[model samples]
Target: MRMHKVNTAVTLGAVALLTAAMGTASAAPPAGRTPHPQPAHPVIVDCVWHPQVRPADFMIACGDGNSSLSSLRWSHWDQGSATASGVNVVNDCKPYCAAGRFHSYPVTVRLDHPQPWKKNPRVQHYTQMSLVYTDGRPDGFDRVVTYSLWN
Candidate 1:
């Protein structure tokens, strides 16, 4: 009876350990990295109409730090055309600002392709943009920002 009780206790302990390990794994960050903070102050910085260009030009100002422009996607709301590209924030310019200081990151997107914006008679032009970022922490506060015009 003593041996059986000891074995039972050991089995229970093993099961608990396994459960905890699985929980931690499930709680892991998405894409194997922590997600940046969602944009708190989202605003359209510039919208330029260029007839010389087929589609148009769009520029957006997003958060300074503790954020990132993970994805830059656009669509022609009036014409139903869309295109996406992976922008190199670091290559373009320093995307982040001084820590704890409010900064604005400007992103300019020029549409070169002749898509719905050029084809649709009703739609003279259309433009849209999006930006995403990962939140920052006290320990990991020194973040390198990326921008287009800066670089």
Candidate 2:
């Protein structure tokens, strides 16, 4: 009888604790008032391999919404691969450069070995990008900028 009573008490205590915890847990956004939606990931254009290919003056949109590569001109694009050159216009927030004026520097761009996108496997990504600063490093930037699409 005592064991049964103890078990019943323990069960009730557990139920009460759960109920309290649930009540204290974050509530869903007030009915009809939805939370702010997150920004969508920037779609990287498959310049070389896509049916509608864009070889020269292509843009690379980094999902982070900060930096992008522009004026990309592919010297040679064949067999689902490409070697290109472009300018990376980055926000150089340096000792004094981040005055809302983006800086541009020459960069070599490469695309190879298409892979499926992380969110949507139906779409493909270059999976590799090698940005080499040919005209020397910017005033406040690194010498080389390497980016892996899938990563």
Candidate 3:
């Protein structure tokens, strides 16, 4: 009876050892495939000093509220840059400030040149924005216009 008990104990110990060994072997990553570290995503600093990611609407004229972007459809948003297609809304101000006609134009937007935010040191924000007019642009504007965003 004692011999039988000793054999049973040995068998259980060997089984447990093999089970642990197998588990450890399978836990390692596959050969020739190293995990890649993901890049940090940058944000857009708004006029009100708010950090936003892929915002649908953004204001361009923070001082007088004369220009802005709307209905933005972002195609790419990554660590280095972002791209979108939207409409540029501007006040013509044909005669005066209060009696100005608003105009809308199709535009493609690009955001890049990431830098550390002034308000938040740890977070990065896109500092430059480029707008390419596809259909039409506002007066005194070129085919492509670049603006420095507020940080």
Off by over 4 Å in 1: 28-151
RMSD of each: 17.1, 13.1, 11.2
The CA lDDT at 138 in model 2 is 57
Off by over 4 Å in 3: 1-40
Sort every candidate by lDDT, greatest first: 3, 2, 1
Give the TM-score comparing model 1 with the true structure, all chains together: 0.22
lDDT of 3 at 46: 88
Which residue pairs collide, candidate 2? none
User: TM-score of every model?
Assistant: 0.22, 0.50, 0.73
Q: CA lDDT of 63 in candidate 2?
A: 43
> Model 2 TM-score?
0.50
Write the number of the candidate with greater TM-score, choosing between 1 and 2: 2
Least accurate 10 contiguous residues by lDDT in model 3: 31-40
The candidate 1 region of ten consecutive residues with least summed lDDT is 38-47
lDDT of each: 0.37, 0.63, 0.91
Compared with the true structure, the alpha-carbon lDDT of candidate 1 equals 0.37
